[model samples]
Target: MTISKDSPDVSVIEDRRLSCGVRLLVESNPSVKSAAISWWVPTGTMDDPDGDDADGLAVLCAGMLERGAGGLDSREFNDGLDRLGVIRNISVHDTSTRLSASLRNEELPSTLELLADMVLDPLMPEDGLDPVRSLCLQSIQGLVDQPPELASIRLNHLALPAPFNRSAYGSSQALESATIEDVRTAWRTRCLPEGSIIALAGGIDFDVAADILERRLSEWSGGSKEMPESRPRIGGDEHVEQSGSQVHVEMAFDAPPLCSSDELPFLVATRILGGGSSSRLFDHVREQQGLCYDVHAGYLRRRSGSLCTIGAGTTPERVSRTIESIYEEIDRFGSGGITQDEFDNVMVGLKTRLMMHGESMAARAAAIAADFHDRGTPRTLSQVAREIDELSHRAVDDLVRSHFNSKWASGVARVAVGPSTPFQPRS
Candidate 1:
């Protein structure tokens, strides 16, 4: 494991073609007292094929992986993890499924072994099917229960077509009909090696950890598949239905993706706009004018294009005023742009926050994997810091002009989730 000149503070060790074509990485955070092991399989919601039942299957497989593995039943697995003092958890996202655990240095080996077994082998019992399917359905239902969450999902549905915008968590009650064969097929295809990225970070020595993983994971093998690239499609009518006391207004417009160099400015501009209570939206809509309870702006970075969003909540009487003010702020930044103070403050906040994220070994490992996945090289913290430092007032203005300009930023998809009659935008 050689440290790149770019990021000496972090050491990345990668093992490719170990049996299952799995890619294992170890990112050492020497200063941290604990370590985290993350198993990333590139099978996410985007990988789901309609009628193939792959999405629900992958999710169910992830759920049952920890129920029992390697001669350890649920009780044994639970007891061993507890005794070892490990924080074991797993999640399946839009792009990948992950199993992660954090533990003290002394307990790393056993925990790693346990995690490996859980990933490599699982006893998916027939009785276990109902609960796992129910849970997945319940989660989908929960999202629908929250108007804001549901609104976001609907927005995604409008933003991207088919598998691209499809719910990673799968649809409601549909999982109830998913068969054992469906999950088996999903596990077979989605959990392949070439798309996998395994990352570890912690207090232990990189060589020893790598050796442990290398010896254990050397037998895994799977064929590599080219990941599909899809673009974000944003079209359709903007609707604001009345559902509650205050009107929840949400808007989304197409923008560039994460891989773009322009992402930095997008980040900076969004922070200055409505990242926190001190932002333009917060100050203008909630502070000075007192027209709304909250206001913020953000960009949802996807594989193809991203979505720039600005949202707010206000009384029926104030909704129109709030939207007007929000739009005004967007126009203001698009034209006059941000001052040096605004840019610097946001950068300072962002840089400080980025550094803070490095405090955790898990974060460091994931960061390395994510950077490597996107750009094929992980950037050093100093380089990133320097990049932020070098961004000038002129540069920010240029960025806004290039990307946030009204013409470049197409169609605003707005949704109002509240019970205030049909929402009509203020002219």
Candidate 2:
């Protein structure tokens, strides 16, 4: 399919499907010399077939794919990408694994072919499994010493249900027992054409890209698998005793899921609450009260569910005070709502970020792939900005009231890592 780049308002985005059912999304930008491609496979840790025992199998499979493919050894495969002057990376998350590359526009065909080989013809060798498994095990072990990460993991496990709660970096016990066959089975069962999206950005011809991908992926085929059902909101509190002078606290609240009508309002509310240096959490908790060394809130977006997470790090002596101050601010924001100045400031910050991301080919490619996976279509900068502008103060206030009020706080999931102390929800 050819997209006309004649009109300034017309987006250069084009979509097509291959014979094998792999979806291809491309955005043509003639102004840039470089192009980026992202191959998004919709299977993640949640799709781990071995249940809790193979927690990190998806991650392990991603690592193994990089080790060898198309009859080439690990070194040979990497060297081939280097020869093309391509920058490559692989990311494994809760719901998907993305293999990405950025290279000169002229190299798009060669790079796509190489990526196809990596996904369709990976040579998951027996000798490669041990090393990958060792690396994964080490990562899991390392998480124990990192208080913040440990606390977050514990909170997710306690708050979320099976598979969704599983970490991308699998458990130590799971990796230790994982074999090459397990990784291969994961690839065969989950990594299929039906649920995959190949997003391309920067200087490229859509017809050529579509043709190259169609011919290369035509022979690849597999059955589509249904994603796991959405789990209920699990809210509770837990504290773990760890020998340390500094304490870590993570609090999570249920929020709107991806592509929901409340998504924009919730995002605006979260930013006003704890987005940056000028946010309420930073100004009140860290600056005014001096209760925490670091405190911030993030909106985690996912297919099945989403969360509004607030975390703080403080000395053991001030841990309880820090927790109280966080809740206090949340209550204050929810009750009084945000001022127009605060809302406008957050909008400016969000717009600046969006503009910056628009300038990079790699960022655009990744964003398009994620949008396609999450919303079934790619969103343009104008569309997103328009949506942000559509959110009024009253709408944002309602969102804050519904999702961050004291009533909501009563059911929050809390995780604290440090010398055990009494930390409970305030009435």
Candidate 3:
């Protein structure tokens, strides 16, 4: 599975499938002495069984993996990696769980074995369960004091359907009631090789990496189960009243999915709206009107469906004005579209980001894995840059009109966390 070289500077991408069903993607760069690896499986929060007590099982499962594996205690396992100078991270998303690490290229073999053990032979000890469960519950409880995070969570609950709406931290009730057996069951059911991908970037030979992975994971086998799908529930207002001087408001609108043709256009539109300090939202709402402490909009690219979210932190006294101002900017953007100058600037910015990611092995490894998971094919940095360059101003403008015109008002999901909900219905 050799992918043709797409760019002069980019190495050829090698995609392979092991007998056990684990997919391997490697981008070898002989110029560097370090390697970054990303192990991805379809064991995300969405895989948790439908029950209040199961909300955070996926997260708990990931945590338990780090506790011990292959008969080694947590301390011994971590010390082994430390001796190899490995930096490891594990995160569970809505649709996937990613285990990643960066280490010297020479330590690849040992690192691979350790990672395989964590995934395939996790101990999930009964004693470890209570501590991790308590941590997860505390994380959910900690959200109460974080207005912005609370608002984002509430927005997702209101905008997305069940399971897909489940948070990475799960809920307090779920964590409290979840037993060790429940987490073990969820892990066995969801963590399979068929839907998993292992990505390696930086200084490593593709053949060597593939061989290492095959030897480590070939005996591990499990069938992958499909996650339940649901459409987003857009256009509604939800308010969680809290005692605070500042109000946190989050607005979400439907956008193109990862598989849609309009994905790039929507991403460009998000940047123009609020990608950075120079974006319309920041320039208008914060810099000009001085209504918000901070404001930004981002395009969340998801396999189920994409979303454009705008969030603002502002005084309760100014929440209404801040929301109205955001709406005004959206309307203006929909009607006016973006200018050629803005297009060029955004294109440059996007390319700059792509180039920077090219320099980081970790970023490249994670990117290829995510691309394969989301699109079934890995993309080169050059491919992404070309796509961004090809996007015309007119096409973006058209997308903005279609997704953010008067339709934005009708299709928006609003969540406010504060002492009062000051926003009124759009007439």
Candidate 4:
């Protein structure tokens, strides 16, 4: 493995590339005593060979990763983590299955080694497969009781393109059809070094952390499976009929990708539309009119593209009007553009948020991993805050003018999960 630093001035951030192709990034903050690891493997729900037929196979594979690894059985594997005082999570996402672990500064070496073992040499025990499969199924089934979450998932399914549109919850059919061998093969083939990222943040030395990973993952190798670029394939208004007292609604429209010039301005505009209690959506839809139990809108994205999302939960009778109100408010915000007052308020809140977020070692760790994947370089909070601080209200308002106008409805998709929702689409 070869290592490099950003520059003498920004020596805190470091980067390393393993000969096998895995990339490692670390941001050292010496004041704190805890370190975090945000590891992203290239395999995820979208990479499942079984597709929807055996959709949850990747997730199942992730669960099996926990059952045992690196010569340790399930029990012993977990015991090792406890001994090192590690707080960890491993789960499947759209483009990458992520593993996050946080431990004391001193525990960094052992914890990272154990985690490396988990990924590089997971036992994937036969006895553990059945239980893991059941848990995956239970999560899918549990979605029935989580209407808002289900609404968002369904919306993503409808608004995005195929293969890439799949949710992390593998369908029951896929889970049942998948065998142990299938799960093992999926991990083996997809768990390659290419496109993988290991990011660490907090009180640690980047050189030392990089050295530990370099040695631990020296043998890991493979090329990244090329990610095909996909265009928007927006679906029409859809609803899921489930017995419930309230309706969960979600609306989505494509936004600029992280790489686009329009990305920053669009991000600012969406926050004004619905970023906090003071946002237009909450202030108008929930506080002023009392239309729903809760309402908010925000931005979300994958590796290449992004979406501007609006979500709400409301009573059955009020569902139609709530949806209509949301649409009108979005249109109004776009048409009228934002005021100087709104722009100033948003900037202050956003800047404050950026500042507060910088305090969390775990958040920083995960963010850099995603950044390396999406932007090809890690960005410091100071860098991000400076960019935001430099933005003029006119720039964001101009984007609002061109992007957030009636055009938002042209490609918009809405989803509702409840006993009853208005079948007819709203303009």
Candidate 5:
């Protein structure tokens, strides 16, 4: 275990790998009276044994973990957490399934016990399985009316490499075929200790948290799992026919993955393009042209790479122009690069955003766990601040210039969900 201190009075960050092969990250913020815990088990969809057939299994298992555990049924378990005034979320992502909770410092010990049992001794009750599965199925069915969400899902499916591209929503066939026994097996096989991360923040002591986890997870031990490499596919345009007055469009272009040299530059670039009302997308498309109510760009990071995604919703009449205008803005921005004034402004904005994010104990805790997954280490606010401070104007501009030459234009993926096919009929 190594320790890193942020300041004399702020928080102390510690990263430790326990004998059980679980990594524990604790950032003790003595100034705050609450604590946040983010636990990641390697039980995400990527680890599904049925491969594509296992899409929704990881998500369903995540939901069932909440139903009961450690001798308590669903109601009793939730009642326990409620009594502690703990706010928690359990969700499945591409990399892993996570249990995140924030509660008062005094409730830390008990909360950890309940959460630990969720991962270690979950009941996976047969009675609860149907409800959880139905919820999962309902969520997938609900997507039909959610064109924007559906468009994003379709875009990710078309753009990202296989397995990574699979939706967390289980396919209908997969969800129906998934028996309770299979979910039990998935949990047992995938919820290993080696590759998991337990991150804690706010009013916590690293040694104390570690002791609690070490005892509770003493019997939890196993090696991690890995997936095979598949051929990279250059994603193209896609359109889904839906009866809607407004067309939802999503476009994705290349960006660097976490731990890459260009990660910071790309972050700055995308932020400048569509991060907020202050960005180019909002300025040129929404406000100036009145093309849509919203037009924004965001950076989506996966372990393999990243995407600078731009989305806008507008009428059928404006859909084509909206898409062309977005690309025009992208081309102009890429061709001209960014001004030093706006670049400097974006730098400050990022620094401020980072500081603000650090204020929330839960957000900070989730970030710590994410850093461990992405970079194999946790970074303090000051460390991240220094990285932001070190970002150069030349670095960002040069990266943007190089991007347009190959990746963004050639492999750009566009998806539109509307009555008309602005993205073509896929013929």
Candidate 6:
């Protein structure tokens, strides 16, 4: 295993041809006694609309894959995992589907082989289809039952351009329409060598894990790498309705990509405005006014731009006042920015958190993969800290003013999910 001097704290081995064109990253962390193995395939809901089944296909494939594999039924496989003391699970996000497990170092080889087998050779049983479809449908229905989650999903739909405006989890309509063949086809196409990343992090040796993966995956390999697909950006159509108890508002504007240098100041500006409980929004909306139960804001990302949002759960009666307060803070920060003390504190807080994140090998591996996906290499903690340290209130304020302007703000959308009226900003 070779680790660059850039991130000496973690050793990373990148295997480009572990299978077909699938890439593998093996990271060693001596601090933890367990191993975390993660497989990231570029088949998230975002890829779904392009294919026949769209996002639902990847999800169904994930569900059916786990039902049986490697001469074991779901329960039998799960029991074997339990006997091996392995913790296994899977999840699908907007951009990828992930299968992960953590186990004692002693079971690393068996776990790796089993995982490879499952990813490539699932039974995709016909009888398994209806239950998986029912489960996905229920999950979507359940999202409507939770206020915060429903509000957030609606906010994203309003904020981002289509088809990402759709749920990260496929919509009920799409999931219901998905066929078994569509699910299987999506797996065959998207989970190719080039678009997939396998990451193993923790106490195990790299050579041992690599050999196990190579052998199990070699015969199954015959595909080429895939270039990642492009998704929509932040700006889009806007919609709002009066139908909830608390006003759920989310405003997104275009900002620099994660790889851009401007990201430092932009992040700082966002933090000072609404990054945490101590931020301006919380201070004004919650502490001083007593109008809102929750109010703090943060950012989201894309390859092209980012989003800064302020959300709160407040009465329809107070929604106007609350949004005004939020805008007031935005204007104040844009005009004068924050003080050096404020900037220093936020920078320190964020840096401290980043440092703490390094303690986990799983975090390290995920970070490395995301960085490689975005910027080709991970930024060292010191590099990130230095960028934060050099930030001036003026620079960040400019960023806020540039990206968080009204032209963009008016495009801000709201998705209220209770008994409140539509919130209208004061002129």
Q: Which candidate's lDDT is highest?
A: 3
Model 4, range 1-427, lDDT digits (tens) per residue?
1111222234356888977788889899888899999999988877865344657888898899989889999999999999999999988888899999989999998998899999899999888889998998899899988998899888888887766778888888989888899999989998999999999999988778878888899899877688855655557888899996889888888788877778788888888988888889899999999999888878886664578888888999998888788878878887888999889998887777765656778998998998898889988776776677778899999888777755665555789898876758555
Error of 4 at 85 (Å): 0.7
Which regions of candidate 4 fall more than 4 Å away from where they truly are? 1-11, 229-234, 425-427
Total clashes for model 6: 11
Model 2 spans > 4 angstroms off: 1-8, 50-53, 231-234, 425-427
Number of the candidate with higher lDDT, 1 or 6: 1
Candidate 3 residue-wise lDDT, 197-238, digit = tens: 899999998887788888888888777677687754545898
Query: Candidate 4, TM-score vs. the true structure?
Result: 0.94
Q: Which model scores highest in TM-score? A: 3
| Clash totals for all candidate models | 13, 0, 0, 1, 2, 11
- How far residue 425's Cα lies from its native spot in candidate 1, in Å, is 9.4
lDDT of 6 by residue, 53-84 (tens): 35577677778878777877778766777889
- TM-score for every candidate vs. truth? 0.88, 0.94, 0.95, 0.94, 0.94, 0.87
Q: Which lDDT tens digits does candidate 5 get at residues 280-322?
A: 9899999999999889988899885688888998999998888
Candidate 3 worst ten-residue window by lDDT: 1-10
What is the model-wide C-alpha lDDT for candidate 1? 0.70
By summed lDDT, the worst window of 10 consecutive residues in model 2 runs over: 1-10
Q: Clashes in candidate 5: how many?
A: 2
**By the lDDT metric, which is better: model 4 or model 6?**
4
Predicted structure 3: lDDT: 0.85
How does candidate 3 fare on TM-score? 0.95
